[model samples]
Target: MEDKEFDKLTPEEKKARFQKAVDDYNSGFVEVDYTFRSVASIRVEEAMEDAGRVSEEFKPAQIKVIYEAAKADLNLEHYMNPKFSASHMKFIMEQEMAGKDVTWLPIGKILHRSIVDKPLTRDQIRRIKERMQRAEPKDSVIADLHEKKKEAARVPKKQGQQKKKGER
Candidate 1:
């Protein structure tokens, strides 16, 4: 609200407005998915029963199997991100059911792309890190290199001579 408009409210009216805003914000937190809650409860119970110890360490073969299964289950991978809450998924699904175009912001698009994209191998990731380190402070070094390339591509014009018409 504009400062002048806010100034017109009495103290009790201001307090009521603030309380309503707080209630509206807090209401979003109460919509929980029972299925997700149950799954979490089961995992917590299992962890407690196991005394926080892994019974059998995952071998390479077992890890591959689990990874493939997760990839096949789209919902599992989408919800794996820490920032994706149950409510967000529900809202998106509701929009889809209503025949609306479900759009994502750039950050969400990048996150979703990363989740489903083929992952780089360990060696590839290592090489990329090395390259990034070699190109540290990207603005200065990269800009200089690009500038040099552009200079090389330019043709020197003759001194004291105007270009002919249509000579570019």
Candidate 2:
């Protein structure tokens, strides 16, 4: 669908259309047999749970197995393509530029790991953090003034009213 035409539908209608398309695709699916063994016989959810367990134990070998299984089952290659991943990084930079707090290190590490050949490194994480920090905005003078005004209002007033001792 063209962007203009797609904009005409309400969000709910758009979601319904997307779901229908997925249902139709699944119904028309076919299985192919190959000599190659499946990456792992586990379901995606189960693999993720296993990954979490391995992560808790800090075992890289166990984590690698789970990651491989997830990559095959979830088709992470397409979603984690460098071009797609860069766009997500760009979005995080934009958010930081707009004075929003966002962590880029974790996202960068995940993206680095998703690549089949390349592995994540500490240097990449430091670079991502540096870039995000550069994108952060400096404090505005007007915001400082507003904060001062609010702080002054919160102070208790001195007890020096028209009420003298023994005077009603």
Report, for every candidate in turn, its global Cα lDDT versus the true structure.
0.42, 0.45
Instruction: Give the per-residue lDDT digits (tens) of candidate 1, residues 32-112.
Output: 342222333333234434444332443444333333333333232222222333344433334334443434312221221
List the candidates' TM-scores in order: 0.21, 0.22
lDDT of 2 by residue, 8-105 (tens): 99999999978876674455422226232233423433544543432344244434444443433443222222322333433333444454444322
Candidate 2 Cα outliers beyond 4 Å, as residue runs: 1-117, 138-168
Separately for all candidates shown, the number of backbone clashes (residues 3 or more apart, or on different chains) is: 0, 0
lDDT of 2: 0.45
User: What's the lDDT for residue 20 in model 1?
Assistant: 69
Best-performing candidate as measured by lDDT: 2
**How many times do residue backbones clash in model 2?**
0
